[model samples]
Target: MTIALRDAREQLRDRFLFWATLALVVASTASLVTGAIALHSDAATYAAARDQLLALGKDAAAIAAPEFYPLKLMRGMIEQVEIMGAVIALVAGYRAAAAERGRQTLALILTRPLPHWAYRLAKIIGGMGLAAVSLGIVIIATAILLPVVSGIGLGTDDALRLALTWAAGVFYLTVLFTLGFGLSLWARSPASGLIAAFALWILVVLVAPQIGDTMDPDNQVAGGVFAQLSVPKAEQDRIKAGFAGYETFRNGIEVASVTKHFERFTFAILGIKDTYTGAPVDKVLAEKRGDLLFLFLFSLGLGGLVLLRPINPDRLTKES
Candidate 1:
């Protein structure tokens, strides 16, 4: 344990970690500040729009909902944070392992009295610890800074959501690191390992999501562009029955209300909508947690393989 702690401390003291941590802090602070400013500006615009709509005798309740504006602004800000966080994770993860290989220090480290697993474990824990601390700082800064700038305070639920999102960030970092570490072991040089890891990250993050969406059964193309575009009579009747008592919105205002007859019916029971665009907040949170867990397990599996591989760090010559 003492040795592991020493290793972690040494890792943290490296210049790479120092600069990476600084970069993360600056990036996160800037993003939060910009988001706060944008939200405040948006709030002003919304107020002006609301006044104009009111002068025209239009219902402004939907557009002027205080909760709606904050939610939209906050969600957008969170998404930006998520994107930056992922990039930080990927860079940190790849460098964590690749640096040792680049320096040809892996052989020396493996030759130490410390067991191979300890070194690998230390790398994983130390790398993740640094990322978590960096992310936490950003989260704490945002919590304090946002309310001051945007007049929007984060609640306990929001904090929990942010934490969960950060955990997911950690999982992604771990996956990238493990993949990079494995490639470092397999490749002759650090450059090749980094390239391979980054390419894989791009494929997983970008292509995988698109593949998932494409394979979704609900996402389908129907009839030609201009063939009266009507549902089958039976389907039309079913749809009408489902929407019999639902409110409909056009633009930002609710213009029509269906009868109250379906009030007792569950959304599922009535099949009113296949899925709501904005899901129940709790479900979304749970899904994020699940994604984090999946990534963590996958990374762990990869790391395990790296641990079990024979320690032949001297296989690559100086020329190679």
Candidate 2:
């Protein structure tokens, strides 16, 4: 508790965390505004359709009003988090490890009455708490800006879904934080961790997803290649079924990315994915079980490494 609070205050003051949080807020506000415009358009269309049906004398009971999930307005916010959120966590992790090494703070902490592993464990817990704070501010902004921009109040169901997505975001950031922190500790030089972290980020967060998307025969063209060519869904599936090996390889690349799983889980929860739109929360969670497992295992693995990796102060002191 002591360490976690101190981590929050200290990281917020650091230039990296301060600037990252500010930039994320600015970008997410814009995404939510754009989402609002889309929601209002959908609402207007629903109203027009309802009126048209009434004029046709359709039974009132037959004309069920469309369900509007305003939480769909946060798709852009999710993507922004997918990108910038990793940076925030990575920087926090790097600074936590690198700064302490430069100051020999870990060595000094080890000399205290506390057990050898206590400070390390506390620092990691502190790091996670720090990530939660950074993402919490964005989620709060999302709650505020969503209704104001779209003129549609978020329903209790949608609010609960949004909260679920927020929790997933915090977990996703925790994984990245541990990865960065662990790398910093393991690297011989302080700079290698930051470089390697960004390299993996570029690969897993950015490149892998693109490769998967572009590899899909349906996604090659604007507005979807299959749609543009007037391809039927059944035919598309049948056609791709013959190339199962190719599909498997492409999916394998995407599955390696923690960001992809985070996006998939959150998208299904928030109805950003078309198939999941209007799906019940329980059903969506059940369907996305694989993604949830990946996220959980990713966090558990990274956290285990950070806690268990051999820590040598001699290596830190030697890294001129």
Candidate 3:
């Protein structure tokens, strides 16, 4: 507990955490504003078109009023998490390990009365605590700002979905944090850890998705390539089914990317899945079980790596 509190204070004093938290808040606020404007414009356009058709003596179905879903409004915020959130986690982890080494405290800590695992647990707790603080700010700010901007009240389901999205964000960031922590443990210097961490981030978060799309052109854009070909949905499905093996391979590559899992999990939880929107939370969870499991296992795997890291006092002394 003492070590955890000290580490937390150290992290709080670091400028990076403050800046990252500020950026998240700003990004979330921007997403809410952008979503509200888009929704209102869409509502207006639909209403105008409906009026035009009715004036032409054609029956038009009444358009439903746009409902403000806070989670939906946070789409951009979630993407920022995929990018900046990972960066924050990487930086935090690297700094934690690198700082100990640079300050020559690593050997002293290892020689302390406390077990080595306890020190690691303190670091983990401190790093994840900062992450939770940042994510909590994002969630709370979004929840408060969304309804104010959209003038729509959130129902119980919306609150639940927001909670679920928060969980996904925590899981996603935790995975990235541990990845960096493990790398920092292995790397000789903070620079090396940062480089390796960012490289993995780029590969998993950016390149993997692009590779998946390139491998299966149908995934290159939204609505599938068949939409551009003007094929019916049924035909598109049939054509895609014909390339089942290739599609499976492509999906495997993507699923292997933790970033992809995070995005998919967040989308499911927040009702960004078109077919699953307005569905019960249970349905979303059921459909996204694979993604959730992948994220959980990935996090545990990295954590295990950290826990199993060599704790030789001689090595620590030499490194320090």
Top candidate when judged by TM-score against the true structure: 2
CA lDDT of 256 in candidate 3?
A: 76
Q: What tens-digit string does per-residue lDDT give for candidate 2 at 218-290? A: 6767777777989899998898889999999999988888999999999999998888999988899898978
Alpha-carbon TM-score of each model against the true structure: 0.63, 0.88, 0.86
RMSD of each: 11.3, 3.1, 3.9
- Model 1 Cα lDDT, one tens digit per residue, 1-320: 65447646766677865676566556655656776787777677888889988999998885845542222333333434344545555566556666666566776777778787777777777666766676667656656777777766666655665565556555555655566656655667656766886676566554544454454323445432122455576775676566544412221121110101111111211122234223554665343344344555666777788777765675643323
Backbone clashes counted, model 2: 0
The better candidate by lDDT, 2 or 3, is 2
Comparing candidate 1 with candidate 2, which one achieves the higher lDDT? 2
Question: Model 2 — which ten-residue stretch has the worst lDDT?
Answer: 311-320
Off by over 4 Å in 2: 41-67, 113-116, 229-233, 318-320
Write down the TM-score for model 1: 0.63
Ranking of candidates on TM-score, top first: 2, 3, 1
Clashes of 3: 0
Which residue window of length 10 is worst by lDDT in model 1? Answer: 255-264
| Residue pairs clashing, model 2 | none
Local accuracy of candidate 3 as per-residue lDDT tens digits, 119-213: 87777877778778889888888888876676566788888887777777777888777777767766666567778988998998889977886
Q: Give the TM-score of candidate 2.
A: 0.88
